[model samples]
Target: MTELAPDAGFRGNEKLKGALLQHAALSPAGLSERLFGLLFSGLVYAQIWEDPEVDMQAMDLSEGHRIVTIGSGGCNMLAYLSRRPASIDVVDLNPNHIALNRLKLAAFRHLPDHASVRRLLGEQAVRTNARMYDRHIAPNLDAATRRHWEARGVTGRRRISVFNRNIYRTGLLGRFITIGHLIARSHGVRLEELAETRSLREQRMFFDSRVAPLFDKPLIRWLTRRKSSLFGLGIPPQQYDELASLASDGTIAPVLRHRLEKLCCHFLLRDNYFAWQAFLRRYPKAEEGVLPTYLQEQHYHAIRETTDRVTVHHANFTELLARKPAGSVDRYVLLDAQDWMNERQLNDLWTEITRTASEGARVIFRTAAEDSILNGKLAPDLLDQWHYQAERSHALNTQDRSAIYGGFHIYEKRPA
Candidate 1:
């Protein structure tokens, strides 16, 4: 039978077990990091690194396409809805992600207008969010998702009350930013200075002067050595190795430096929301880039109108695809998850994909390496059914505003 899908189950402990370690390459520290990463994935991802603009450009979605994607933060999936696809199915192994996706879907369905959506998701600190959830959003969610948010913490406060504060600053990414700020403070560097840079020249200068030096410090280097320290970045150990392999300087630090440069310099601070949340730990003012596409005022109504076409599943992609009829799905957004799978797992995935995918179906994914993961690993017999769009993939990888991932790949199904 197919290898038991990685982290596939509804039982809480089983889910956690699956989530904890998808890789075999961990040292003791790596194991700790994997555990931390698993726990981190169980909360809201105030931001996901994939660029939906680049994603939509790659998919070029039409009314005829049926889309499936991993609902990491539920951000890109909602962003996908703006295109008015026939249907989109978003799946994730993390129940928290499924919950987040459902909550977003529910918010789109129940919120009165664009301003309400923005205030709740963007500003994210309104005291009335809990009340709004009570009145408009909570009832619409399934029991599991509802219970997940309503569950109490040690303070006896319902976890849903997180929205009453800056919810963007609550999850693993939030804590990571806070810790980064703390580290920067100890080094006499204000992490916020990146936000004040006026242009690419200024940003590069500021980075060279202020940010780049932080990497060379003893404490920063010490912490960076422990893979657990990066769990906050949503980086798993497998992907960590892939990224580490890319460093021309033989350290992960340079790879990070290049990525930071891309995040800060390649895109203007006024427009890149990912950089805003990263450097400033919150989104910019509404007049600026402000928010993700799904949360933007211009796209709100379109997403709201089409939100009903979306559904969230707490399952592995291969498992989800296995149940679908042949030639049913037209688009797949794999995110960077295959980095977590083994060669057999990858082949198992393509086995189902080759079966279920419609003619001309497009599958897109990102990787921690600039080169492809599937090129040498995936079984050639299964791979031959699809054509890799290398030039477009490389071009799109450059255009990707996220700038975090090293590769963006696209594959199209061949004529049978």
Candidate 2:
């Protein structure tokens, strides 16, 4: 893809920015202060924090079809690329994310070698990363994206400076982690001592007694239940409204509890090298200035090759599906995005999905609520052609890397 110039006529619109967040029910002060850091800073949900360890047992990725996904932080997109699909199209509404994905792709493709690539990205802790970006990464960046990274923080300081400090307290999830630490402190349980706890049972007991009680508190519940409060986690007001619709009384404590439980209790915390990056390292693994794989040597080459066929876009799912040729994509990774869509958007997405699906295509997505997104809402005509493995989805979900999701579903496209 060819590079494009930054918009010369573009001007900051203060009024529009205010109203957009307000319309999303976020306060102007909160938007400018707390939410700004989450959006602008590299404080992402760490989408790849836990390898999904997507089970290749039931699905055959070598079938060689195109793939479409929401490129939240680009980790999963890159992870899926390891499977060697014919092509991958990644779309996201957030331009920051788009730019970030582009940066990763460029680094992976042009960096001296895998080791250097790992040093710059995987380690992410090298003191000269900003220098490397200025030298290698930034020069290659498109004008707009270059400006985006350059405009961040102080001059001569690269964007990676956020990691040198308390980056964990930066994003939505970061704020939550901060809150968790505070709560842990309040209960006289220091989170820094997690390693001291020798057994899983001890970890569970400590979490249940100390952290879990925070969710049950009326004040925490009141604050977190609001849409604006969750902006840190990048949950827009629209998705919050849908989440309200899913619950009986719109109380979010249970949902929050479940996610927090997974974060604290699941093999996720133990096996996830990404989580280790957050709680353990302020930055990702960077060798000299390259990024290393979370996996061992065996999976590295396979994963890197997947990068060849991957393409990231700044588009909506429904629109992308509408334009796709019939029976094109093999796997769909929609990460809890449907909770933000309306019935029409849902229908449009699935319509094209069923129309374009090859036989036995597997579609995976998560939901904000425990209920399946497609349970009864989808039209039977379109629904009949797909198989919903509720039992299997439930079973497979136990293996999901990030336990934060409410539901993990797989829809197998039936014969046309």
Candidate 3:
């Protein structure tokens, strides 16, 4: 598997706090921690979770703003490109992520048209992906990224061959969904049938009849309690603790059930691409408007036209910020990455952010719990410079298409 064990975009603060940020791949807290660490160290997310629509709306990007964002799966960076930002800088510590971002950039720059791009990433089972890569995308890629796609994965096949199969269905989240499907089938539940619902009533009935009981299963309950089973979902140990603490009685199962209800019930299956991927493991074909915003046909030309505006870095966000002139950046998208940080690390990150944020800069992030995490950990003097839009945050939380997170916060820099 492609290991990202050290690729988390972490700024190693002194005191080894950044090292503490990622649970050790070899020496975890326990057996569960080790396994979870191993899973996290791989291509954990072939896609990012935080909704880019929500982020874009929060950032108010246009032609002049500069954005420095965490490039999880590189989806959001492409999404940002669609908005015509002056420039976008994407950073990740994960070599796998950096490679993925580079591959995506190469695809946009080289592909002949929209359909070929769609076939390679959207429908899968393309005959010409490797040929296209060799003649077009591959030649444009940097050596490290080209090497990553050419390297063999578990199937004794180069990872790029997954484009000939299903790329979305190949990563850690993909495997996790596959496992959930197997577990559901063992209990006579057909998860895919949930997609057939015609309306909200049908969706709720299907969940009540066919889906809710799966949550109560003794095996699932046991796994959810184990903590490591969550590794596939990209829930690190620290975030898992915050999730457990937010529960009414400090149990994770009910909390998950509530979130799943929002995912499966609150949104229509026809348009909710996240739900489509969760239950079906692949996005809707090109005709459906359910592909990621960056992949959708309407946005294709705009995203491609602006691909040069984005630059990917295999470095920490702080590293990028340190090099920028003071107040050069206009917006930030943290994406619950800070939930992994400790006080000293948080302080260190904010110190740089405070120094580098442009006037009226806005920062957006999500957390595992319903409350903002910066309250106690951040120094009041530093924290006081930004206004936490609590009311707006609560409203946005309800709108986040990804129902996995508990809180969505928007903090704008107070006028200088």
Candidate 4:
């Protein structure tokens, strides 16, 4: 695990509150924001929703390039290692995310082989995973990270035991998916049946017959109208508003329905692990379903060899970038964080990003709506320094297998 400052968890919580508490505490929006902050302070994403393959292609990563990214579940950062980047500085305001990133790095560096790593992370509920952690991964973790895993949860079992019972099914996002499953079941639909899809045609057919009508239900529509309903998705109050704006009826259900359709229909089920996680609640067997790039056997050796290059920090992205030297970073992956930022925060972040960016540095981010968030929000002087790859962004957005986000953007620094 990478070194951490004293009181890192407390500091991370404070930073998260600062970013999320944008409205007055007494107001409905404020209460929603605070509630989200509380839930987000703990584990959220067991697996990041962004498609790292599309991210890698957008960033055009090359050997020795220095990269900076917001670590969610840490999957993408590990995937990035396959390109042999010189260094990766991962920043996140969520302490759990920081711990998760470090734990993953330790797993890659300390675990005996790819199979053990896969069994621990890729599969669901294996009793041997706790033993594997205790025997191999635990001894290698830093004190802070070790304590995070060893600490008991409400179940009186150590947090690390989640690996023994489906880690992906435990987080806020995981629980949200569980709720979605229950709701679908109540309506007489089995979402997991989509996994049996053999082709895109069958996938679309399954979605249309089994999933599409659920959105039209009076209950789902009403639930989506409330901002609090999406808190399980790690979507804050501000982001909820943006997502709601995307719907023609000014309701969130339609927007969600469209994204879900893409997830179910845009790619082959065998090829999209995101779909596997969504419908099956766990990745399928190696031969039956696709896995993230980092977990694949072909890249395991390379990722493990490069694990030492990653440094995990529990801090705000803008603040971390401010501490770095100018023109030092070659790639930036924002991962939908800008949706939570106010105008001032947006400007502050872009200032540091522009200052730290190397020549031709490429920056990628996602938005809740189908357009770049920077157009009117960021200062012209700052925004003008980068060239938006509108055509490429649209193309890559379509290729993103996660299919949850409305837009995927790529911006390249212009010549001085």
- Top of the candidates by TM-score: 4
Q: Total clashing residue pairs per candidate?
A: 0, 24, 3, 0
- Candidate 2, residues 180-228, lDDT tens digits: the string is 5676567565665544444568768857776677776776677666766
Give one digit per residue, the lDDT tens place, for model 4 in 1-416: 23443234433566788888888988987888878887787789989999999999999887889999999999999999999999999988877887888889999999899999999889986889999999998998988889888888677998889999898987899999999999999999999888777889999899998899999998899899888888999888888988878777756998999999999998988899999999999998967988889899999999999998999887788988989999999999999999999999999999999999999999999999898899799999999999999999999999999999999999999999
Best lDDT goes to which candidate?
4
Candidate 1 lDDT (Cα, whole model)? 0.80
TM-score of each: 0.92, 0.80, 0.92, 0.97
Q: Model 4: residues >4 Å from true position, as ranges?
A: 1-12
What is candidate 1's lDDT per residue for 45-78, written digit by digit as tens?
7667799999999988877689989888888988
Worst 10 residues of 1 by lDDT: 1-10
Q: What is the overall TM-score of model 1 with all chains considered together?
A: 0.92
Cα error, candidate 2, residue 337 (Å): 0.8
Which residue window of length 10 is worst by lDDT in model 3? 7-16
Worst 10 residues of 2 by lDDT: 7-16
Give each prediction's root-mean-square deviation over alpha carbons: 3.3, 5.2, 3.5, 1.9
Model 3 C-alpha lDDT per residue in residues 248-341, reported as the tens digit of each score: 6535888788888888888787777888888888887645438888888888998899999888875676667888889899999888878878
lDDT of 4: 0.90
